[model samples]
Target: MEETVANFSGSNGPDNISGTPGADFIIGLDGNDTLFGLGGHDRIVGSGGLDFLVGGDGLDTIFGEDGDDTIQGSAGADRLSGGTGADRIFGGDDGDLVFGDEGNDTIGGDDGNDTLNAGDGDDRVLGGDGDDEMFGGGNADLLRGGLGNDLAFGETGNDTVFGDAGNDRLKGNEGDDSVNGGTGNDSIFGDEGHDTLRGDDGNDKIWGGDNNDVLYGEGGQDILWGNDGTDSLSGGDGNDQAYGGGGSDSLYGDAGDDSLYGDAGNDQLFAGDGNDLAFGGAGDDFFQGHDGNDTLKGQDGNDTMFGGTGLDLLLGGAGNDTLAGNEDADLLRGEAGDDDLNGGSGDDYLNGGTGEDQVTGGAGNDSIYGEEDADRLVGGDGDDFVRGGAGDDVVLGNEGNDTLRGDDGNDALIGGADDDMLSGGNGNDELQGGDGDDTLLGGDGNDTLSGGEGNNELTGGEGADQFNFDGGITTIVDLDLDLDVLDTSSVLGLDTALSILGSTTVVGADLDILGGDGSLLTLKDVTILDFADFLGIDIDLLNSDLGIISG
Candidate 1:
């Protein structure tokens, strides 16, 4: 065994010292010295100044103490440390343990599965091209896993971590950080402050821990969670799963068919370009669906949702929500609370479940139902089917051949254009049929039926029924004329009957008795006995309150 100590000072030329092949000791002190332990369980030390320490062919220990240093453990199971100053430490060829104890250091495990620990200051640690483990101890650090399945931890301060190619686990334990899980199915965590995490190209699991964070699931079917604070997450390409956990967060399902959730706080979710399903679990949230057929639910709080350019399903689950189906065929449900629902430009279906609501069938053939409370429903242009479920409702079938029903509750129903059917089902209702020959059926209770401005049919079913005649062109047929009344208040210009026979037509004369428009009336299913009150009089005197013809 041999021992040698070589000291070089005063900014001189570098000194290179080596030991014998047996167990030996070599040390270099100051002034850019190089220390080498060439064989047999040797120990080499480089203390102060720019130094280099190398351990060769043995289970040796090497240390580069202070100033910019480089320490390499070559060809043996070695221990290498760069203690203080900006240093570079390499664990070469064997399973070695390496450390960059201080300063901003760059540390790598060259071959063998090794452990690289970057203890403090801003540092870079790489499990170099092997299935190794690395730790970023403190300060802002960069921890990368190379070519193998690795485990990386960014313990504190702002850090950047990459799981370069294999299945790796990257954890950012504290401070605002950036993490990338590259290529493999990795698991990543941003433990505390605001963070940015990417599950790049793998079916990875990425979690944004605390504070406001941003996460991206870039390729495979990944799972991302924005655990706290207001965060933004995107499922970039595959059919991924994302969640906004508490805080006001934003989640996007981009490209693939995805499932997203807003668990709490007021959040926003976008189902971008793919058929996706999104749920707004609590708080006030907003949801948007673009291009593909998607399904969205605003589960609680006052939320708004828009289904843009796709045949989507939108649900306003609770609280007062607004849902709009912007393009293709859609289905919308306002489950609880007072809601406003719009079906834009497609054949849509809308239901207002409870509370006072308003629904519009915008530009397509839509079916709208007011399932509870007082609701207002408008069937915009197409042949729509609109029905009012419970509370006092108002329904309007604006265009095309449509059907409007006010089921239960005191409702008002209007069939606006084209040949349509309007039914006031139960309760004291008001039904008005406008334009192109409609059928107005007032089902029950003290109902008022007006057949407005068209050759229409009016059938008043039960209770004190009032058949109103504006006389544009109308037909009033009371099954039991002995129990129904013909309201002649606005029918002052009504005509004397052209003919009246049993179960035959009673056509209009349009006689200008009083001052209203000269319109026609066809009273069917009645005999002359039904009109006994104005019998044998001129058509000018048809202005009396004819109550059931005094049966």
Candidate 2:
């Protein structure tokens, strides 16, 4: 047992101490005591019994006069003080300064670069490492900046802030606050109520003050600003930029080369890649150009548009409308409402002027024209051209090498591939031809034909009749009747057999006028005979392995 109380003054003895070591100057003349500065550089003082103080190394100074005290600065460079009750303080190494002067305190600046303050009730502050700065002076506080490059502040109640690594800065000064910038290169600010901001990596900057706010820019090259209420902004990668400054806002440019602006109310914009540009400056807005080579503008209220890839340009200036150009080489216009248009890929150009409109050309090589209401047109892919000008209409040319014309309604025409031509000029009509080499003309209903490939020549002129062929060719003639009247139902179903007996009527002898009922007969001249009882049915049929019919 050892005790050396140098210059120890006592007004009321036994302020509770078990101290008997060298170089000790413990002073607590009043009721509180538990002062152990057992090693060198020890100067401990607790003028009341709610105190336990230890400054075991050089450069130490500890003091807690009233109740509620625990001060620990076990190494050099320490100075802690919670002179009033309700205090717990720690500054264990070099560069320490802690003060929780009034009640409700837990303050720790546990290593070098430490300075902490929680002076009022409901306070918790930690700035434990180098480059640390923390201040939560009033009630309702919790602040942390535990690594290098740290600065945190939640000076009033209803506060929680953390800027845990290098390049950190956080602020949530009043109530309704929460902030985090937990990685390198961070900057966060939500200075008033209704605040939440996160910018967690290098190149981070976020600001969302005033009511109704939320902001996030979680990676490098980040800058998010939703400075007013009704805000949400996200630009979480490199080449990021987002600004939705007023109420009624939502902005996202989540990949590289992003620039989004919806500066006024009634706003929504998304352009998440390189070569992106979106602007919906005033109210009533919706815009999406979600890939490269995009330009969208819906500057006033009553607007909706989407042009999601390269070669995209959409503009819907006034109210009442819908427009889409979801792939390359697109241009859409609905400068006023009562409009709907889609040109979803390369080689697309669509226009639907004045109210009452609908237009579609959803693949490459497309062009559609439907200028008024009561309109519908479909021409999707290369070699498509559709024109349905006035109201009451339906027009389709669904594949390459197609041309369909239906100038007025009560109309339907389908000619969907190469070598196709369909025209139904006036009302009351239905026509179909969906493959190569097709031409169908039925300007009034009660019309039907199925000849969808080459060598298809059909004419079903006036309503009441039906003619069909899977193997095409039909002809019948009687010039006088001779050459043995060509037996076997006219030259034995001639797949190649033409016999004109006399008057030198046998032209290279190759004919098949199918009496075998395979139904393909067109023998114009059985070797040039305007003579021999003119009973002509040699019907020239040459199938020398199906070649040489080029015209």
Best by TM-score: 1
> What lDDT does candidate 2 reach at residue 23?
49
For candidate 1, what is the lDDT?
A: 0.84
Give TM-scores for every candidate, taking all chains together and pairing residue i with residue i: 0.89, 0.46
> How many residue pairs clash per model?
0, 21
Candidate 1 global Cα RMSD: 4.6
Best by lDDT: 1
Estimate, for each residue in 154-174, the C-alpha lDDT of model 2 and write its tens digit. Answer: 867778888877888888877
Q: For each candidate in the order shown, give its overall lDDT on alpha carbons.
A: 0.84, 0.68
Clashing residue pairs for model 1? none
lDDT for each residue of candidate 1 in 1-551, tens digit (9 for 90 to 100)? 24433322222447787766666666676778887777777777777778888888888787788788998888877888898899988888988899899899999998888889999889999887778889999999998898889999999899999999999989998999999999999999999999999999989999999999999999999999999899999999999999999899999999999999999999999999789999999999999898799999998899999998878999999899999999799999999999999999999999999999999998989999999899999999999999999999999999899999999999999888898898999999998888888888898897888787767778887887877666565666564556666665555456522211134333532222323344333344453334443323333344552312212
